[model samples]
Target: MADKVVVFDFGGVLIDWNPDYLYRQLITDDTERRRFLTEVCSLDWITQQDGGQPIAKGTAELVARFPEHESLIRAFYERWHEMIRGVLEEGVALVDKLEAAGVPLFGLTNWSDETFPWAWERFSVLRRFRDVVVSGRVKLAKPDPAIYAEMYSRIQQQVPGVAPQDIVFIDDNVKNTRAASALGWHGVHHTSAGATEVQLRELGLAFA
Candidate 1:
C-alpha cells in the first residue's frame, strides 16, 4: 500500500448510485413507469451514460431504442440525472481511508462527460479523486482491454516503475474485474461494502 495504485469503480462501489431515484422523479404514472423501466430504460443505465445524455438526446435515443415509449422518452431524459445521484457513506469512507494511506488511487468509471459535472455537483466525494479515467473522456469503456491498457500506460509514464500488475482493481462488474486480472493486474469483484473492506485489508490497503 506504500506506493501501489488502486483503481475503483465509482457507481456501485463508492456511492450507492441508483437509476430508480431519477425515474421516480420523472415518471409518476405507475403503468408508464413500469413500461419505461423494464421495457425502455432497462431500469439501470447509469454506467451506460443514460445519466450523461442531454434531456433531448437521451429522450430521442430512448424513443429510437423503444418506439413504443417514444412519447415519454423526453420525460425520462429529464429525470436521468437525478436517478444516478446518491453516494454511499461506507464507500466514500473506504476511499478516504485508501487515500489517506497513500495509495495512488484512480477512478475508472464508464460515464459520459455530459452528466459527470451534474453528478459531481450533487456528490462532493468526487473531489477526493484526481486520476479519473471516464469512458466519455477516453472513449473506451470498462471490460475493454484498451481502457486498462491506456490506464497502465498513462500511469507508467506519469509514475515511473509502476507496472500494470502492481495495480489492484475493484469493480462491481465481474467481467470488468476479469479483464483487469487478465492483464496481470489483481482485481476484486465488489458486491458489498464488507466484501470490499475485506479486500482492502487483505491487500494491506485498509487504513487504521
Candidate 2:
C-alpha cells in the first residue's frame, strides 16, 4: 500500500465552531434564536463571505435585509471569536498521530480570510499543517471542484509524484468528501474521531 497523504477540513472536523455559541448569549429564547439563525444569518449567507466577499459588505447587506436584527447581524462578524468553542482534542490527536508517523498533511478550509487570523492565533493544531488553503484567501470554497483542484496542485508541489488516489481527505460535510472522492481521492466522512480512525485504518493508514 502506498503511504497516504491526508488532507483535512478544519471547521467542524478539527475545530469546534458553531454560531450558536454567540447566538445563545445574545438571544435568550431558543425558538427565536433558531429562527434568527435560519432566517437572517444562515450558513448560505456566511458562505459568501467565506468565498472572499468583504466582511463589511456581507454584514451591511445582511443588516439591510434584517434591519430589526441589526445588532445581532453585526455581532456575527464583530463578535465572531465567541463562536469558536475550542479545538476538538480527539481530532487533534489524530493529526498528531499522523504527523508522528511521517504522513504528509494539508488543510483545505472554507473560512473567512479576516477571521482566519483569530483562529490561527488561538488554535495551535492549525499550525501543524504543512500548508493550508483558506477559501476566503483563495476565493474558492469546499464542494467547489476548483478549490479541490487548487489543493491538489499544491499537494503535487510538496509531494512530487503523489497521485490523487493516494490522498485521503477527511471532512465533516458529506458534500465536500464526495466532491473530493469524485476527483479520485480517498474521501473519509468524519462524524466523530473514533469513527474517522476506523475509516482511516480501513484505508491502511494505521497511525495508532
Candidate 3:
C-alpha cells in the first residue's frame, strides 16, 4: 500500500469505448460489412494486436486473410476514426482532480493512432497528464508485458527514483490490470470515478 505512480487505461476506463459504435458507423453496406468485420475487423485480431503485434503487419495480414475483401478493408479503415468522438465526463472529472492534486498520472492504452487526436480535440484533456503510451505509437499494446515494461522504464528515466509501487494504474479490463500487476506495477479495475477516488485517496492522490 505505497503511495506513488499511477498508470491508467485510456480507452474504457477513462474514455468511453464500444466496438459496436465504430462498426455501426463504418459499415453500412450489408455484404461488405459482414466481410469487413469477420475477415478484416475481428475482435480476435484486435486482441492479437493488443498482444503487441505490429499494426501495419497485423492490418496487412488481416486484410490479406480475405483475398476478395481487401478493397472493403481500405474503405473501412478510412472511416474508422470518425466513430470515436469524446470522453466520458465522469472519467475526466476524476482525472482533473488527480491533476489538480499534482499526482503523477500516466496513460497505458491500447488504441489505434487515429482515435486519440480527435478525442484530444473534443475533450481538450490530453495535455493535463504525462506520458501517453499509445500502442499505435509505441508499437506495443496492453495485456502484453512489453508495454508495461516500456512505460515503467520511461517514467523512471523521466523522474529518477519513481518506483512501481509509487504508481497506481486504473483500467477497466481485467487482463490489463492483471498483466500490469505481474510486472510489479500497481493497477486498478476502474468502475467509476467516484469509486476510483477512494482507491487513489489511499495512495495520497486526489480523486473526485
Candidate 4:
C-alpha cells in the first residue's frame, strides 16, 4: 500500500481567520457591525471572492452598492491581514508532529487568491505542506468533488504512487470531509486538535 498522505484545510483548521475579528475593530457599534457583515460582506459575497473574483473588483462593486459604507467595504480587503489572528497552536503542533514523523503533508483550502498571500506570509506552518491547492486559484471550492479530484491529481503527479484512497483529508466542515470520503479518501471532520490526533492514531498514523 502507498504511504497515507494527510491533507489539511487552511482557514478554520490550521489558522484562525474570522472576519469579525477585523470588523470589531472597524465598526464600534456591535449592532451595526453585525448588520454590515450580514448585509454588505455576506458569506455568499466573500465566497465569490474565494472563487477567484478579484478582491479589488468585489470591494469596488460592494462600495458602489452600499455607497454610505464605502470605507467599510474597502477595509474588508484593505486590512485583510488583520483577520488572520494566528496559527492554532494545537493544530500547528499536530502538523509539526506529522511532518516530523515523515508523513506527507498537503493542503486544500478555500481561500482568496489575492488575500491568501497575507496568511501564507504570516504562517510558516503552511510552508510545511508539500503542495496546496487553493480554491481561488482554481476557481473551485470545497464540498465540490472537482476540487478534491484536482488536489488528488496534483498529489499523484508529485508523489509517484499516491492514490485518492491513500489521502486522509481533514476539514472543519462536515460537507467537505464527506465529499472527500465519497471520493474514496479517508476523511476526518476536525473538531479539535486532540480529536483529530485520536482519529489519526486510529488510522495507524503515529505522531509525537
Reference-based lDDT, each prediction: 0.73, 0.94, 0.71, 0.90
Name the runs in model 3 displaced over 4 angstroms.
25-40, 47-60, 67-76, 114-116, 202-208
Q: By the lDDT metric, which is better: model 1 or model 3?
A: 1
State residue 90's C-alpha deviation in candidate 3, in Å.
Answer: 0.6
Model 1, residue 42: C-alpha shift (Å):
3.6
Q: Report clash pairs, candidate 2.
A: none
Off by over 4 Å in 4: 28-32
Clashing residue pairs, backbone N/CA/C < 3 A, model 3: 4-166, 5-166, 5-167, 5-168, 6-167, 6-168, 7-168, 7-169
**TM-scores for all candidates?**
0.81, 0.96, 0.77, 0.89
Model 2's alpha-carbon lDDT is 0.94
Encode model 1's per-residue lDDT on 1-208: one tens digit a residue: 4456888888888767665676665678878777767766663453355234444565566678778666556654465556565788888888878888777777788777776677777777776765777776776778889888878876776678987767888898899999999999889899887888887678765576
Instruction: Indicate the TM-score of model 2.
Output: 0.96
The TM-score of predicted model 1 comes to 0.81
Per TM-score, the best of the predicted structures is: 2
Report the Cα RMSD per candidate: 3.3, 1.1, 3.7, 2.1
Model 3: per-residue Cα lDDT over 106-154, one tens digit each = 8777876654566667656665667778776677777778888898988
**Residue 165 CA displacement from its true place in model 1, Å:** 1.8
* Best lDDT among the predictions, by candidate number: 2
Q: How many clashing pairs per prediction, in order?
A: 2, 0, 8, 0
Worst 10 residues of 3 by lDDT: 75-84
Model 2: lowest-lDDT 10 consecutive positions: 199-208
